[model samples]
Target: MLPKHDVCGEPLYTPKIIFKEQGETKYETTDPYVWCRKCKKYVEVEVTQK
Candidate 1:
């Protein structure tokens, strides 16, 4: 999960999963978005794999 703020430090909420990709390796990539109350829209977020 990313920080509580977006690029411009706007509060984020309701993380929604957009899609998932399977790579050749064991790691799986996922794309998600969060609702930005300030912008009144959804913004992409970075997810770190462990």
Candidate 2:
């Protein structure tokens, strides 16, 4: 099941992951929001970072 937006009650999507290289290590990053087609804006969702 997909998460719902707090304001719009729309289904939230998983944010994309980006990788970056710093020195000799790889780092990960992602957006804190999900895309909403109806709202046309990113909606914040619960996420756990590792």
Candidate 3:
């Protein structure tokens, strides 16, 4: 079961993942999970180095 909403106090479903990376730096964020509308889940990833 999903965790209760942080505010509403109900099961909340999130379906999205975002990734930001550059050269050697990488950042990833996700909202639980969900089925991809086309093939598999979709996420935006960016890579950059400092």
Candidate 4:
């Protein structure tokens, strides 16, 4: 999912690559939390493929 601003209306930190899996197919997963500088905490989010 594309990163979006936090609830405080501040831009979130860039999504971090958590891991990469390789098997029949190769895909990388990103961290579910979007860090907010103003909030000083993480906002949970779900990543999905369009």
Candidate 5:
């Protein structure tokens, strides 16, 4: 039988809004809110220092 992903593997989820930015590129967060996983949103990818 096939194994359950959420139990044996990684849980399915969405992306988040909060992310990084760099020069002209953007790196959106894959899980910012990290609430229900589905609440996660995403923008363009970026790069910067905290």
Candidate 6:
């Protein structure tokens, strides 16, 4: 199920995976998430590995 906005109680949209480079190592890291149109932000929905 999709996550709901805390303030607006609206459903969030699942987009592309978000990734971040850690240190000098080229490892990409991120968590599973959803995008809130109402809040205009990405909200984490599940834990993920680096």
The best candidate in terms of TM-score: 2
- Report the C-alpha lDDT of model 2 over 1-50, residue by residue, as the tens digit: 77788777888888888889999999988877789977998877778764
Q: What is the lDDT of candidate 2?
A: 0.81
Question: How many Å off is the CA of 9 in candidate 3?
Answer: 3.9
> How do the residues 1-50 of candidate 6 rate in per-residue lDDT, one tens digit apiece?
65566778888664455556677656444446777778787776654333
TM-score of each: 0.46, 0.73, 0.32, 0.55, 0.27, 0.41
Flag regions of model 2 displaced more than 4 Å: none
Residue 3 in model 4: lDDT: 63
Summed backbone clashes in each candidate are: 0, 0, 8, 0, 10, 0
Q: lDDT of candidate 5?
A: 0.38
Ranking by TM-score: 2, 4, 1, 6, 3, 5
Write the number of the candidate with greater TM-score, choosing between 3 and 6. Answer: 6
lDDT of each model, Cα atoms only? 0.61, 0.81, 0.46, 0.70, 0.38, 0.63
Number of the candidate with higher lDDT, 3 or 6 = 6
lDDT of 6: 0.63
Task: Give the worst 10-residue stretch by lDDT in candidate 3.
Answer: 41-50
Q: What would the TM-score be for candidate 5 when compared with the true structure?
A: 0.27
lDDT of 3 at 1: 54
lDDT of 6 at 43: 73
Q: Runs in model 1 with CA error above 4 Å?
A: 1-7, 14-31
Give residue 38's lDDT in candidate 5 (0 to 100): 37
Put down candidate 5 lDDT per residue, 1-50, tens digits, no spaces: 22113323434333345658888888865443222333243322222225
Per-residue lDDT tens digits for candidate 3, residues 1-50, read 54343334444345455888888988886644433334334333222222
- Distance from true position, residue 17, model 4, in Å? 1.3
